[model samples]
Target: MIEIKNLSKAYKKRKVLHHIDATISNPGIYAVLGPNGSGKTTLMKICMGLVLPDEGDVYIYRESVRASIQYRRMVSYLPQIARFPDNLKVKELLQLTEHLRGKAQRKEMLMELLDLDPYMDQLFRNLSGGTQQKVNLVTCLMYDVPLYLLDEPTAALDPVTQIRLKEFIQHERERGKMVVLTTHVPHLVQAIADEIFFLLYGDIYFHGSVEQLIGAYQANDVEEAIARLLMYEQEKVKI
Candidate 1:
């Protein structure tokens, strides 16, 4: 459903993504794994048309992101950080989002699932970090979109909320929605990702299923596999 061709991006002298090419043709949960500054967020932003690629193009359902804004209608993005007007109440913010987008198909359900109903009348600035993240999730997931781009979705979430979010993501996949997320959590990827794209030094270092990643590194689990991959890359740099 999505194709990225020869995509490259640089910030002044620092290159974030280097001629990257990848495609997602099926409906499932895909995880983008990478260390900090490895361009995971940049890649997703490019796909969402929030950032322009210097060298190539991203096409959603056959329409180039560079060619049109309409392609974004199919995408719902949850940014790594959530920011809103401090004075607005939680419910008011949700209402504003609904006003901008169309009516959310599952807002109330998400709010309930995230335990956000109690804080509905509270001001945005008054919510705790975890609660704020829950609000962010409710806004993003409430829309019934074909594609979801979630960046560090479980940032401030507690274990219970994190598990709920995972369940929601899995449910989305079951409904034939394509869910793409970037996370440093190994267990989260192991639990929900049908496929993974591992980014290192601005390129796709590995792309495969969770079992394939562990098998490729000869590791017992996802955490060890990732550690091995990082150590191997560091040794290569030293060589």
Candidate 2:
């Protein structure tokens, strides 16, 4: 449902993404992996039209992202950072989000699953960091959209909540929804990601199934493979 071709982006003299190309035509979770300053976030932003590309274009459902915004209706995005008016209560924030989206939300079950009932009347800023991340997940995942873009979704979530989030991801995949996530959690990638895209130095270093990632790097595990990829980059600089 998403196609990126020859995408490139830069800030002044520094490039963040370089001629990246990929397509997602199936329903499953795709994990974008990269170290800091590797352009993972920039790639996601270009897809959402939050940042314009210096070259190439992103297409969603046969429409070019640079041309129109109507394609966003089919997308649900959860940013890396969740920010809101600190004075707003949890329920108020949710209500405002629904009103802005103009769509019926499936929030009740998610709220219960996340154990957010006690915080309904509490100010958003008063909640703990983990609680805020849970609320963030509820606000994004409770929507019925063709594509879900989550950046650092498991951040600040406890072990229990992380398990719950994985369950939700699996449910969506079975229901024919596409989830593209950016996470450094190795276990999360091995658990839910059907495809993994590793970004290195503004380019796609690797894009394949999780098994392929392991096999290509010849590592016994995901962590080892990731380390190898990082070291590979360092060696390139020394060359």
Candidate 1 structure quality by residue, lDDT tens digits, 1-239: 99989999999989999999999999999999989989999998898888988999999989999889897888999989887887999989999999999899999899889999999899999999999999999889999999999999999999999999999999999999999999989999999999999998789999999999999999998999999999998999999
Q: After superposition, how far is residue 34 of candidate 2 from its true place, in Å?
A: 0.4
Name the regions of candidate 2 deviating beyond 4 angstroms: none
lDDT tens per residue, model 2, 15-103 = 98989999999999999999988888788888888999999999988789899899999998888889888799999999998988865
Query: How many collisions between residues are there in candidate 2?
Result: 0
Q: What's the alpha carbon RMSD for model 1?
A: 0.8
lDDT of 2: 0.90
CA lDDT of every candidate: 0.93, 0.90
TM-score of 1: 0.98
Q: Report the number of the highest-lDDT candidate.
A: 1
- For the record, the alpha-carbon RMSD of candidate 2 to the native fold, in angstroms, is 1.1
